[model samples]
Target: MSREPYRARWAGTDYEASADLVDGRLHLRLYGSAPADGFEKVAPGRFVRAVPAADCSAVWHVTTVCEWHGAPFLVHTAREAELLIEYTGGDALHAAGLGLERIERGVYRIWVKREEVSALSEKLVKIVSR
Candidate 1:
């Protein structure tokens, strides 16, 4: 397993994350604050209207797992929209020789061969760590 750091722009926002290639899977952990609108945009309309953060805004925590080269890659799933945007912009799967598909609204999936995936993962780790 190798640890790597990556930064990119998503949904007009910048994010930082650490990635690891383990057992042929790419594991990602994203770090960032919640959107300016806060939980009002994320939570149900009724819930947001009823409950507002008076003292402190709600923080965001997202976790997602995707298959990479037949291996499962676990990712911090915060910033759903932003992550999709970045993926489309060719940041995550760029040059990984992976096939990208839109699984659903604001969601995407990637497919790649094991050898290519391993090579790309190593390259990404080196680039980000530098």
Candidate 2:
């Protein structure tokens, strides 16, 4: 599959970093200092740098599950995937939820939509700022 690169402004700098899929792996890199504020992806190939409110007590962020190795286990926290492993019946729903697209003997990725991430983050920020 053709993957696009994700870009975002480093935690506190104007410089941006690129997160790309290299050899079927997520490779995030920048030429300067590391992101101090940390970051999370809001969408596929899109990232957002966290901005903390004054005296913020907590930080809200989303995580991506690119690949997992659990031998018929693959839990993706991003997009819609499937579990391509061998499992017994009466638990199809439970097993399928273990994958993002298709899990086969463990190994895959996951990504959430931009709208969901943005909305969730916004809600958390409001609560934290209060």
Candidate 3:
């Protein structure tokens, strides 16, 4: 990925989510509200929709994913606030490189590797002594 993973962070929260376009398709991975199905056309060049938590499984992780192939457009939504992402040229992935190097075009392989790290961060906690 690039410096920024095409994401949306609202209200100084770490639970920000991001999205990318793979071969003219939307690949959204976020830990908040599940994006709505399809965009509602508000005007000739505007669309609006909601990414609500419609199911139990969608409560966490990236739950919203869609595919669109045309002149390209933008998705405007939020988790607890408003966010925006434009699906246009360069934003869409044409190819990817994994273990064996660059994979073929239009081929997307999702290999999620999970590792266990106990002390990953140090956050301030309110300590009360009695």
Candidate 4:
């Protein structure tokens, strides 16, 4: 069966990210950095994908699992992804109740509440500004 594409949006802003799940994994392709107050481009990274622990690295085992619509999604789903975002400390949305939904084949949608987005954005700004 084919999976759907996924999209994620930050509340109160045009900032967003998109990815797809193929062969039981989600692929997040980072194009540009978000345009928040203190968002800094740490390093130039390319396409990264997330997959089930059985298929990917064993490190993914330590990540948390989030449940949405009775489905469990992995937080920091991928090792490389987790490190990349952690370096910048900007992708903390995963901890702020970010929700993901499969919209259609190879498509998925991620939603973050306005309040949480604001708080995350502020935290990122503080870190970057320092």
Candidate 5:
């Protein structure tokens, strides 16, 4: 069956957007306007939220993923990885070069150098998660 396309405009020209109902997600390409900070310009990911339109249609925003910016390194062992998973730091910690990708749990991986790698990861997680 045919579905109604969502309409939007970008760069001054008019455009259209469409979606497909897949196993567990909706996928689409879109051009549109949003609040100044409505979106981030990074690469896309799976998560999203729907905003209700006046007429009850939905607007989709690609959600951000959890990622710690491990400056200048990579996790080299299971013990280090385990340390990262168990760490969570807070405000006082942020100033110490630590943080977490709190939007969601980023079990992805970690990067680090010698000294305080786990401390850094824990501190960051607390700041963002809190």
Candidate 6:
């Protein structure tokens, strides 16, 4: 599925990053210098940069399951995805609690509408300014 990239500004640094979810993978890239400052999909919320900048050594994994209400919840395991409540039961009642979208049979990805990143940026600005 095609999707617009999610852009985010670093909380206290002059750096920015963008994430893209494509073909069941999340790709992230930093616009500034950092350990892992390349365009690649590593882990859900982790990045690693090689010391030589060409070591090409890294590993990443996404969580396929999460805990909610003491129960195992199947999730698509992506930085952009939320809790997939379909496993419990694709019933309307469950769907209402947490928006659920089936990515495939027996697998689902949580639905989190595009958030207003600007609002979060503003909040970060306040915290940093203090």
- By TM-score, who's the top model here? 6
lDDT of each: 0.35, 0.33, 0.30, 0.29, 0.32, 0.35
Q: Give one digit per residue, the lDDT tens place, for model 1 in 14-77.
A: 3444445656654444335453433234333321111111211221222333444444354323
RMSD of each: 15.9, 12.8, 17.9, 17.2, 16.7, 12.8
lDDT (Cα, 0-100) at 23 in candidate 3: 63
Clashing pairs in 6: 35-49, 36-48, 36-49
- TM-scores for every candidate against the unseen true structure: 0.21, 0.20, 0.17, 0.18, 0.19, 0.26
Quote model 5's TM-score: 0.19
RMSD of 1: 15.9
lDDT of residue 72 for candidate 1 = 39
Per-residue accuracy of model 2 over 21-127 as CA lDDT, tens digit each? 65665444433333233545555555444332322332232222222333222222323433222332234455457544334543333443433221111111112
lDDT: worst 10-residue window of model 5:
121-130
For model 1, which pairs clash? 62-77, 63-77
For 32-85, candidate 3 gives per-residue lDDT tens digits of 333334545545644333332221122222222222333222222333332222
| Candidates 1 and 3 compared by TM-score, better number | 1
- The TM-score between candidate 6 and the true structure equals 0.26
> lDDT of model 6 at residue 33?
32
Show the colliding residue pairs in model 3: 35-51
Compared with the true structure, the alpha-carbon lDDT of candidate 1 equals 0.35
Ranking by TM-score: 6, 1, 2, 5, 4, 3
Candidate 4 local lDDT, 57-116, one digit each (tens): 211111233444333343332232231111122233443433334344433445432222
**How many clashes would you count in candidate 5?**
6
Candidate 1: segments with Cα more than 4 A from true spot:
1-49, 55-58, 61-67, 70-96, 102-130
- lDDT at 113, model 2: 40
